[model samples]
Target: MTTTLAAGPAPVVARPGPDIASRRRRARTRERTAQWLFLVPAIAYVLVFFGYPIVKNFVMGSQDYTVRTFVSGEAPWVGLDNYVEVVTSSIFRTSVVNTALFTVGSIVGQFVIGLLFALFFKRRFPLGNVLRSLLLLPWLLPMIAGTAVWKWILDQDGGVLNEALRAVGLVDAPVHWLTSPDVALVAVVIVNVWVGIPFNMTLLYSGLQNIPEELYEAGALDGATGVKAFWHITWPNLRPVVSVVLVLGVIYTLKVLDIILGLTGGGPAGATETLATDSYRRSFQEFSFGTGAAVSNILIVVSLLFAVVYLRANRRAVDE
Candidate 1:
């Protein structure tokens, strides 16, 4: 027992030395730095492109920014006066009404026609892909060019459309599509619908492709074929996609400017003056930067509302 001799002063526990610990700490710091480095470009891009403009727009909206401001280098603070004036103006009412009509008409026309096209193409056929690709030409063409062509086609005199109508005896005289205030908005809507259909068809077709064929086969066994199968199986499966398409269509249609501007230039009598065109008219045409920014801010707010709705619906779809 005495020969145990205090167990040789206890075994020495080998803890990390200062050099090793320091190396570990440095490695962790470097890892964190690398992660931040990877995020730097994205963060900077967002700040420069999105953040600054939003802030600048908000600030300009609060100030009396105009041509004078550019010359004097000072935008006087006018608080909500610009917004008040814009909202109280008579054209504001007209613009709002026209915007609603344009958006609704475009969305309805695009979705119904696009869905029909998608369903049709879902069936096997020769040159189906070729025809679908041809449909995309409208979507692919430059907006200005497309609208320019549309203008020629809709011209009151010497236009192909009126020529065809006359050939078929559909009407005795030209429709004055872009000239008459009553019909200008309708003509603009038709052009927009034509442009938007391909987009909707592509998205909806992708969604249709994702649906499992087994479900349809199983549905047929239960007497769910054709419209019955579509209504019971396809529609329920496609509801999420439909919601996304409708919301996106509404949002895009709300902000449409180029087509309307190129086709009607805010129309024969402001018949097609939407908030987008009105904002452009104010900022550049009238040199009322404050009012234009105000109108744009209103539009941004409306868009945000739809975006929020989209987010909620998407989340709901995911949960289901």
Candidate 2:
């Protein structure tokens, strides 16, 4: 056996260049970095403002917290007493009902009126743009100021409403519109409708405008006219918009605070009270943070429920 074979050539070393796995890992890191870079500002804002407040509010709500004692950092633990009080209290339940009332009334009234406007303004007419612009006045005005204007307009003695009523001999005496729960609730609903109409009108009008004119013409040729044509052509096409506006109207009007606050402050018997107003008073005025949080959570639940319903409706519409 001969001899020592020449030593095998020194083992060759592989280059350190990236293999498939390493390359994939590097790419993933780059993508992750890009995602975080894009999200940093939003994350920071939420953490600093919304997130911190929400968490702190939750923590403080569990304690017997108040401004004076909070600074000393010895806030007493109150357990679920706050929650007990909130649910058991008569005020929260009344507010829930009032909110529901306001939302339902406003949405129905606004839809009827907004559909009218959408139909009216659908076609090009003289000064149509001007009319639409003027229609936006209620929506463009600041919420508090706008509601305040309505408040004054509904004032029992000096309101323009009463004045107009008397001028037209519609009433025998001035009505205490805001001082009575029954009337005040109705008045607030009216104000909400006024504010919401322009929004729904504009949105529905845009949706209506998107429909192909040929569809209407075809329906007309088939002897469908007026209400029949609208039922067959317009309503079907505008269904999505209608659903969206109705759902959005429900959500927005449900959380409505300025309108109720400016008009009624939930006065006369909590008849005009809503979850939003109740939450505000509980947290700010009554120093019942837990109760306020509970109300807010309920409000959020209601909104989310409606949102889910709307989305289901939209999906069904799409599937059809």
Candidate 3:
């Protein structure tokens, strides 16, 4: 009864040696390398396509690059002379004014109309989806084709718009939509707004969709309904989305060339000329590549400033 089994020795767990630890470190390094390898294609694509063009533009902006430069194979370095000429030119003032008016008018029209449409479509109705899909036609159509059709519609004579106005007694004669310098800028802005409306509507609709229904219901219970509710509840929630839409609208409107070019060709005596068209004219039409590059570089700087502002605002929104 007093006999007991002898105690067995403690089993020693093997500690990782230097070799095993080194092998583990190597495996981790390999895993990280594999992860970064997946990004190579994207990085290379950006560097080749975006980086090269931007760098070339910057170089061209600093030199006297032109048609003759092509023949001579010598682009004499001019430093900021191109920029100075661009800024001091008489056309520069007109382009700046037109650009500002075009941008502001287009954004305001697009945002207002798009917001109205989005609010309208947000309500459940018969064939709402169909109508919403139809609204995207402007955005989906080819820019050149759309602007061409718009040109015909806005023509001074034998145009649908003039005919409609005359038929309705709104105008006694054809209004020179595209031919008059005074109205050409307005016409271009109208076309741009038409093309841009669907984009704003789509983005704003998505943002509206994300707002919680409970917040609205709660607001209603407190007697904040309709406009008041929208102001106090909906607007506060939608401000971040609004900021994004506005910034993007400004950026896109700033560089719009096709709409203006197709509709006005930067004329009726350069009435609708913007920075974009001016740059194109300087480089291709006039063959002053340096000046064109300089104008474009200025545009790039403006766009970058807006982009910076957008990033900061977005970060703030996220933090809140």
Candidate 4:
């Protein structure tokens, strides 16, 4: 005990070796440099394309920029005139209603069809792979080609749909699917649903795949089976994926341009003119860029609202 003298204050620990610290600093610098090198192309692309266009659109919308009101020099600002005109105008009002109908209809139809196909594919039956690929064929086709094919099927006089109806004696006359204002919207929605179904199926199928079989086994132990298991486990698991798919579908359906332009050109007295088509018609067709841009901005606002809601839902899902 007497020999165990108290130790003196501990020697000041040497700082890290200079070479080791230097090597770490160099390694960190290299890593940072590599990260920036990888990000350079992406940063450049965003600034050039997305950033520039967004800024330009806002700037262009601000000025009296229509072909009618345009001048080479700085444009005179017309405060709220474009907004007022678009809101008050009759065609614009009609366009708003049609857009609403088309959006809701497409979402409903696409959702139903997509859900069915997704469920069908989840079972992994024989030929499921072949069927899955074939199902995606419509989605893969060029927009122009897909529209052309639908045009053939929907041709009032000589279309295959009419021929089949006649052969089956389902109706007396070949239904003028596209020409009639009443049915034209529905027809376009049908095409959209059919085309969009594959995407929904694919996304949902993947989500379904991620559901652990252990959950189902656990449920079975509790006497849960079939639809009950699906509701309790499968649905909870897929809800996150479903939210994303539907929100994206809403956005995609809202911007449905080529299909409407290709099929009907918003014809039969503007029955099929969605907000997107209306924007195109006003801007390009009539050279009213300001008004078109306003409509576009409105669409963007709507999309943003949906995005916000979807993001909130996703955050909640992750927390759960």
Candidate 5:
């Protein structure tokens, strides 16, 4: 005879009480609100600092905002007159050209010298770390102090450089570095390059360190050594880092004011007067805040264009 099978008890289904359901919903809402509260300070900071300044600058560019306007609290709308005056001014062309030269010269000199230093330091040597650390001194010094020292070194008469040259019989007369229009731009570029080299070197050295040694070993096995190996391996690997460095260099160079102001004060026929200095001159020196704002807005546009270029470059780099 077959044994009868016993039926098992049904599984119990527990439903939540309305009170429990509401409590869970309330808990989730509270958690989300807490999270948002954590982010509020940062969001508010950006809105207040960056957003407000940029919008105010744009608005100021369109109005005749002078020193008098600050006292009177009346900035009359002038449309594009500020922009028109900025672009049409006699020194506008000179400032534009000088800005281009300064940016290019500073970036090129800094990157090249920095790359060489980075490569040199890649090899293990005595006091290598110490030397690299010391290189940052120029970068760490106050801009005002650095420029002041450079000013003395580059003085038209009684400067160390001219004296050294005379001692070595290199030149018969003192070279007016900051005084002559032809030499002032070069002097400013030199100072800027010196200040920027350490930054480039630090970044490039870090990038070089990130590259795998095994790749270099493998490359060497295929007769890719020294320059060949670097061209095929190091450069390709470093392209992304190089792009970042170059783009940042361009952006920083574009807005350089303190160094130029301290070194030359955009003097000697406005030879070294960049967009930054020109904007300052218009606003503070000439008391034409509208024109200053207009110049600054134009500078921002130029910076944004470069930013677009950086985006494109970064995307291409990622694709590759």
Candidate 6:
């Protein structure tokens, strides 16, 4: 009849074997793999440069590693003897105390001064960018060079700092900034603080810039301005960055060697001898590699403990 009796079931149309989602999934996987391939070189470089030394240090800490081990490659296992000796040594307590003081002092000075500088830079002014760039010179200079310059500035008799103090009538006699045990650590801390300030200021300023002007404007409408606005808006917004800066500063300051070594050489009756310098003395100077590794391992643990505390505090802050 008219329709050829039901048209024998409409002709079947061919459909794609895979769903759109499936095709997209395959494409995303390929893209991710390609992106990861680009990162392989960087990952490998880090493993070779950082990972190997960490592992080697751990192994050495557990063995009777020495200068001879480097030549003969025969390091006998000594278990925790190295650690025991390091912990019991007379210098251990002093080094620990010095390490704590150095890290705390440097971090406090750096963060406080850096925050002030960052706030100063936030204000609009002529040549502001140029001034900020110039501030980075101290940070850009090599650590040894900065330390050498600082040594001259803090020298006992002929240093500029002493001369300035003498001119200003701050003291009766030239101060022994590096030689006197009482003030050597202070001098080292001052130099470290100077070198670290630019880094902190740059990071903090970046954080401040990331904040939207709209937030400040809105807060201003709600009777929030100046110090009040900073407490309510700026501080809250800057907390995460501040946390990172503090934690990184602690880690870096804990391992500071160049400035201390160049300035005081951990001398004047070991006034400036922190764990880092002590570790260096043991390994390179005294050729007690195992003891040096042990001290370094302790430092690593301290750094890790601090990082853990910071993470917990950050989590609590986020939750609240």
- The TM-score measured for candidate 4 stands at 0.91
- Residue-by-residue lDDT tens digits, candidate 4, 3-44: 777889988988899999999999999999999999999999
The per-candidate count of clashes, in order, stands at 0, 0, 0, 0, 0, 0
Instruction: Encode model 6's per-residue lDDT on 1-320: one tens digit a residue.
Output: 46555556778898766787799899999999999999999999999999999998998999999879889989999999999999999999988998899999999999999999999999999999999999999999998899889999998889999999999999989999999999999999999999999999999999999999999999999999999999999999999999899999999999999999999999889899999999999999999999999999999999999999998989798789
Candidate 4 regions with alpha-carbon error over 4 angstroms: 1-4, 8-12, 17-19, 68-74, 317-320
In order, candidate lDDTs are 0.92, 0.86, 0.93, 0.86, 0.94, 0.94
Model 2 residue 211 CA deviation (Å) reads 1.2
Q: Write the per-residue lDDT of candidate 1 for residues 1-320, one digit (tens) a residue.
A: 35654555777899999999999999999999999999999999999999999889888888999989878999999999999999999899999999999998999999999999999999989999999999999999999999999999999999999999999999998899999999999999999999999999999999999999999989888999999988988888888888889888888998899998898899788989999999999999999998999999998899889879777977786687
> Of the pair 1 and 3, which is ahead by lDDT?
3
Candidate 4 vs 6: which has more lDDT: 6
Q: Which stretches of candidate 2 lie over 4 Å from their true place?
A: 1-36, 43-63, 74-80
Q: Which ten residues in a row have the lowest lDDT in candidate 5?
A: 309-318
lDDT score, candidate 4, position 122 = 81
Q: What value does the lDDT take at residue 303 in candidate 2?
A: 89
Against the hidden reference, what TM-scores do the models get? Answer: 0.88, 0.83, 0.91, 0.91, 0.90, 0.91
Report residue 319 deviation for candidate 1 (angstroms). 5.9
lDDT per residue as tens, model 3, 1-320:
69999999999999999999999999999999998898889899999999999999999999999898878999999999999999999999999999999999999999999999988999999999999999999999999999999999998989899999999999998999999998999999999999999999998899899999999899899999999988898778777778889889999999999998898899989899999999999999999999999999999998899889887977797688
Q: Output candidate 3 Cα RMSD.
A: 3.8
- lDDT string for model 5 (204-313, tens) is 99999999999999999999999998899999888878988998899899999999899778988899999999999999999998899999999999988998988797
| lDDT accuracy of residue 108 in candidate 6 | 96
